[model samples]
Target: MASRDEVECWLTDMDGVLVHENHALPGAAALLQQWQDQGKPFLVLTNNSIFTPRDLSARLRSSGLDVPEEFIWTSALATADFLKSQVPGGSAFVIGEAGITTALHEAGFIMTETDPDYVVVGETRNYSFEAITKAIRLIVNGARFIVTNPDATGPSADGPLPATGAIAALITKATGKEPYVVGKPNPMMFRSAMNRIGAHSENTAMIGDRMDTDIVAGIEAGLHTILVLTGISDQAEIERYPFRPDEILQGVHELVENDPFLAEIND
Candidate 1:
């Protein structure tokens, strides 16, 4: 594994590393500012593709963080790329937010409200019984299934909420069909993000909270991984997990403090 000093680009997960339930974790913003000031390259990679990079950028800035659309890479974007490979210019049934849908449309996939060539699932929004039935029928009628991520639930300021993976699971159970998932813990998303930045895993380090999806994916992608204890997976959980991170941090803000000049280093 390469040393932290050797890492040229850093990729981080947003929810656990930067905030919890909309509340900026201790030092999250400062850490981001610190990196920016130091000129340390970093990008925020997220599974939530409901919002466009621009939309998410505005939201992050509103929440007291300074982020730009260019610094964001979302699963929705990755899913769109995946769909492009599978069915370019083909019709699709997408169940997600504007970010995912807009990307799909831009990729030349037709978004249909009725029977379609393919069905894609992401974070659920206003899913009614009728919508479920329509999705089921389409799948039954030979529509291919594609899930953005398999996260069962996501962390929020309030607490945890059912994520798109949960909704995708419901559809899979109802239709007895499986969907191809493309998100963290899956190198497809990582590869896409790397491709976007033109950064190789050898020069990039993935810093995130969860071991399963975040760190595991980093390892599989041949990138260095750092486990942040700011969110889901705790210290004990890390010991039990098969994949291990190259380094551990309390949070993004703490990461800022870890600079040798900012904080004293000891043996």
Candidate 2:
């Protein structure tokens, strides 16, 4: 793997690396500004498919991170991109919020209930039983199943709530069919993000907090991977994974502190 200095493009997980619970982490804003000033190609990546890129960008802004909509990549967008490539202007029976719906619409996909080409599932707070029933029936009848991510649960103030993977599992139990997931842990997400920034894996770096999803996917995509302890995984957790990230740090603050480019700029 190439050293951090050799990297020309960067992809970082949003929740852990930059923000947590709607608040920007230490040095997150400065790091983004540094990248912008240096003309570095970078993107903020998320497995969450509940909100559109515009919505995510605004949320980041609220957290004091100035990431633009175009610089944010979600699993929703990657799913739409994958499906668009598979079947241009295809139709799907979708169970999701504006994120997945908007992406599919922009990709020329027709959203319908009857005899759709695929049954696409994404993240939503309101998972209707009726909608799930329709999805199950459609999948049982023959529509291909697709899920935005494999995350079984999402963090909430109360506790962990059912996510796309959990719903997908329910549908699978009823229909006996597994969904083709298109999010983190699947290198396709990174590849699509890299393609968006016109970055090659050899010259790209990925920053994430989780070993199972972010780090593993980065390694599979052939990009330099950095793991931060700000969210989810820590030193002990890192040892659990057979593979390891290229670098591990306390948080984004350390990343900004150690950056040679930022040092040169300060000098």
Candidate number with greatest lDDT: 2
Off by over 4 Å in 2: 257-267
* Residue pairs in collision within model 1: 21-156, 21-157
- Encode model 1's per-residue lDDT on 1-267: one tens digit a residue: 568878877788888787776667777688778778888677888998788989888877877888888888888889999888887788888778888898888889888966687888877556667767788889988999988888888766688888888888889998999998998879889888888777888889898898888988999999988888878888789988866899998666556755542354343
Clashes of 2: 0
Listed per model in order, the count of residue pairs whose N, CA or C atoms clash below 3 Å is 2, 0
Candidate with best TM-score: 2
**Per-residue CA lDDT of candidate 2, range 1-267, in tens?**
758989889899999889989999887888898789889999999999999999999999999999889999999999999999999989999999999999999999999998999999999999999999999999999999999999999999999999999999999999999999999999999999999999999999999999999999999999999999999998889999899999998788767747654465559
TM-scores, one per candidate: 0.89, 0.95
